[model samples]
Target: MSLTRKRKKELKRLRSGAEDLWTQQQEVLANANALAAEARKQAAYYTREEIAPRVRGGYDQYVRPAADTAKATAGRYVGQARERVVTDVIPAVGTAVGTALSVVDHARAARSAAFAGEFKKAGKELTKKTKAATQNSGPGAGSVIAIGLGIIAAVGLLYAVWQTFRADDELWVADEEPAAPASGTTQQ
Candidate 1:
């Protein structure tokens, strides 16, 4: 196409405007890059000077002491458990096993002794010892039943209190019927 004089002049003006815009955009981009570099430097300096020290101080002041306390508590509990196992549980288990084995051996000896006609005297002593062992001075059947009933009553009382005081929206009885949905809506 052949351009007219006015169209050529307009095209030249447009070209200069485009170049000016391009130069402005390059300057803006350079400024933006410089600002971003300065921001990064400031962030690094702030982190090194303020944030790192604050974080370190917090760790030393709060975290370190709390961790040490927890560690000590855990260690104490573990030591107590170890001591209990060594002193109480192990001895109790050993004593129980020893007693059982001794009882079995004694029964066997008594049976053999009985065959030799020496059991009549030994049997009376055994019966007395057995009776003494079996007669525990603990709670009787009536006491056990009373305690169980008391516990049940206490649990029932707690349940009643909880039910009375609890904030359960679902359990609330509404005083009025709910409002109907809008006429434009339909239930599925």
Candidate 2:
């Protein structure tokens, strides 16, 4: 078969899109991790500057290796699917998700460790704020306000942590399988 002009154009676009998507995926993961570190810093958990290098190294070591494996696996799957075999993108997405999950676990552990190591007075600032809110409203409003604040803080932290691994879904997907052969084509 001969290559057509339109086919060549489509192939070029596909290749470009694939490259762009990979670069975009890396950028997204980096931003998410950076934001998570920033969240910890803004909360006075610790100096996030010190964490960036370690996080970058983790990406280089763990994520890069996992992603490389996933790419190879994905290419093999695509080869199989192109043979008219019914294959899915699960391997690609699964590898990416597994890597992200690993990172999430590490980040959570680091966060807890940081919180534990810091022996700074806890709840004193919160207590002051709670008291201030109570004065503005009523006497019994303090505990309720404190609980609400606690819930909000918990949710915010969860969100920040979640962001650290949210790029997995965007990283990889399975290719479409080849179409079935015609039934009337019985001759080999």
Candidate 3:
């Protein structure tokens, strides 16, 4: 009544049928072996001379031609290999040399370009330094200007101090005034 029960019943029926088929196959195999033994017994009566010529003829008709064809194909392959070595390989070596030389030429050109760039940079730096040296007259001129300014400032300060000291003595006197009464405070 259920699907599981029906499936189990079908599986049991198939297993029984498989067992019957296996028994039948075993009987058929035994019969075949018995027939093969009888056939071998009958064939044993024939001498080698009867079978040898047929086998040899078959080899000559089929195997010999195939062997000859294989040998010819191998000979052609050897000849082609020799020609390829002579015609293709030798010239390929020259082509490889030319390719290598081109690579070397490229490397040399790159080196030359780099050298030119470096030379240009050095020239620019030299020109800049030369321009700076010519315009400023080197470090000595800067130091000389600095020292001259310092001396001028010192001399002017000294002249001002001397002029103030050499003024009339009355200019240094403080004027006295009468003190005013303070509300618990003195002038600070």
The numbered model that scores best in TM-score is: 1
Candidate 1 structure quality by residue, lDDT tens digits, 89-142:
666556555554656766676677677889785686467546644664664444
* C-alpha lDDT of candidate 2 relative to the true structure: 0.68
**Model 2 segments beyond 4 Å from truth?**
44-188
Ranking by TM-score: 1, 3, 2
TM-score for each of the candidates: 0.48, 0.22, 0.33
Number of the top-ranking candidate, with lDDT as the measure: 1
* lDDT by candidate, in order shown: 0.80, 0.68, 0.73
Summed over model 3, clashes come to 0
What TM-score does structure 3 among the candidates reach? Answer: 0.33
lDDT digits (tens) for residues 1-188 of candidate 3: 55698899999999999999999999999999999999887787554557777899999999999999999999999999999878876565555455446556555655565577876655555555456446644444334545566799999999999998786877677788879867886778
lDDT score for residue 186 of model 3: 71
Expressed as tens digits, the lDDT of each residue in 23-124 for candidate 2 is 999999999999999887786644455667788999999999999999999999888787643233444344445544655655555556558764233334
Cα error of candidate 3 at position 138, Å: 61
